[model samples]
Target: MAAGAPRIFVSHLAGVAVFDPNGDQVARVRDLVVMLRVGRRPPRLLGLVAEVATRRRIFLPMTRVTGIQSGQVLTTGVLNVRRFEQRPTERLVFGELLDRRVTLTETGEEVTVLDLSVQQLPARRDWEIDRVFVRKGRGGAFRRSKGETLTVEWSAVTGFSLEEHGQGAENLLATFEQLRPADLANVLHHLSAKRRAEVAAALDDDRLADVLEELPEDDQIEILGKLAEERAADVLEAMDPDDAADLLGELPEQDKERLLSLMKPADAADMRRLMAYEEHTAGGLMTTEPIVLRPDATVADALARIRNPDLSPAHAAQIYVCRPPDETPTGKYLGTVHFQRLLRDPPYTLVGSIIDDDLQPLAPDAALPVVAGFFATYDMVAAPVVDESGSLLGAVTVDDVLDHMLPDDWRETEYDLDGTDDGTDGTADDRRDGTADEGTDERADDGTDGEVRADGA
Candidate 1:
């Protein structure tokens, strides 16, 4: 940037609250609009895309912006409530700029765009990109230089510099890669169909699986169908088995079989085992990756396993004590020890000594209400699922149970965008499975062995 050029980071300007001179808050800036220019000239600032109440996004022309400062954007005129649509020549600073690959003028080596600082002109009528923050340039197999950083004027770079048909689309995906799966999924859900598919295609299998699990069943199927068959199978294997099975159940029998055939033999076996349960059964809602251990395991061993950061809160609450340790069919399901027991018992105490058998383990075919009632009756967070052969199968987590307890079309409900429920009741489906928990895909948790059970009941 030119010496002492008044500059504000592009990130600072984004999401700033815009107000009128009369002091009435208008909308928040969702992104900055810029128009690409010919060789050597920087992309010119167009306007601001702001989102207001009532869930509408409108355009605020830069000319109307009276003042720009940290945390506040003052406008001299009215904001047109017209939806902001991207023109052929325009690009978004956040959506299209940040995280893009740009070639440094000094090094001629491609570096990653981390952040940009925009400077208002001396005339105060125009704004231009000023300083850029870059990391080590691109090298081997998507690997970037570590601890490498550079700050330079916007004039020092080139990339996403042209107004082409598909300019910045891939950069958009790169920008999203920094977000958590749930956050990325939220962005994907709001995007246009073509854009969503493009972004989905760019994500790796595990990440796509994570995002897909957070999406509604219909959206999951739609996105999966767009992927190559082998890729789709890989993604399914990456997802939690129960979630993968839930999605496969929605597909046609032929389509389901085709995808299953493409999966690894072990993964396919697990999928088939999970798919065997009815959607509302306790077995249907359980995740097979529960913490299972031999009866001889010590509390210290149990504690170490739960310490794994990736274990969802529900799964870590209890330990299933079995005769043999293969969790695939947790052999001879002896009993369960709640997390609280591990904390209370001595480190060297055998898990078998603390097994809590107060609550009954659910059969694979237990109906939804039975599972829900089991949770409510025992006030539990998770319960073990065992087969008729007395082999430990999996644990029914509270989150999965609660999701099933909600209406089948819960995602379509008019609650908050962040997925918070608004206390409104929803319509129910038919498929009664004995208890009232009928057609819902809810799951549940139940019983422990000791008095101070991990209480993930």
Candidate 2:
């Protein structure tokens, strides 16, 4: 290590605490951001992506970093609470660069990037990539094992870029991983068909499911059509049944059946139920995975589930209690316990003792309008879905209900040339009204032929 030139591997910085000068912890390093440059120049280190208590990520500029030691980062106490937004030139180091393959020009060997070591450039405030830790050649499996490791100057390796600068698909896939699923789907939507399929093929099942759920029906079908039968089934299995069923509903009957046959029996059965309901109905909007407890479950159990960071806001609002056959929701539906009630009760109190029987659950067959009215009248964010047998089936969240109520073509619409989006929407015939002829020629309702006069004229 060069004296007075402090350096830390990016991997070591993951989750390192960020503290103010007074030693009060503020946040943890979620990721490192960098700016890729042209002509083999090392990407300049931008700053840290700090994750706050709310799990929201914010940018911490490099200038604020006072020290990096004792498994923690010290900041200048100055901070910005705004959420981090990526600039076009910025890339997240861990998400976009680490674990990707790069080639060593001298040995013509490919290696996986394990971590990057960065240090401030001499006589300058700027921090730059100094070296990289790479794992070299095991070459037996899809994910290469770490055989021998070495640290090399950043310039000795290649294949890191934000844009298409003759980089390979692996590099592009790395950048894609950094995008949120919706944004990633938009990128896929614009790609050449062949390239889109290539990118789709590169993603794992869960990632593919997330992206597929965000895409339009046409794009969803196109991507699924290009995937192998088994892979497509896997992707569907990873999706929420409602989303999977909706996508499957768009396929031809034979294709849908074949794909379903390839899926796990339980998942396929759930999809069947979801597909049977009208798309805008309560049954269709509900998810089968809401947290469930039996009557004997204690308040402690409910609080634990609610405390789970992964629970969605609506799902965390209450805990459902049902009768036996609990593995699946095939038992008698008892009632639910709201989160606030859990906090009020003793930890050992049985959930059944304080069940909110006054909270009416939704019937699976309830119409969309009825579901909307139920939520509005009761001020509920989520309602349990029960079947005619009085068995717990699922819980319909307000988000799903509201989403189903949106215009079918909402995702397809775009802002107009004047930066305004609302209008008499254009139709398939490229006319505001479907009855108009498809011609670009402008006509006017003037007394004279061939022109529309200005309002004043």
| Top-lDDT structure, candidate number | 2
Question: For candidate 2, lDDT tens digit of each residue in 303-421?
Answer: 98888864568989998888887744659888889988998999999999999887778988899999999999998998999888888888999878876887775554442333422
lDDT of each: 0.72, 0.73
TM-score of each: 0.67, 0.59
* Residue 86, model 2: Cα distance from true site in angstroms: 8.4
Candidate 2, residue 305: Cα displacement in angstroms equals 9.7
RMSD of 2: 13.4
Q: Write the per-residue lDDT of candidate 1 for residues 87-186, one digit (tens) a residue.
A: 6556778766765667877768877776777777774466667688877745321233574888887788877663322222444554445565655665
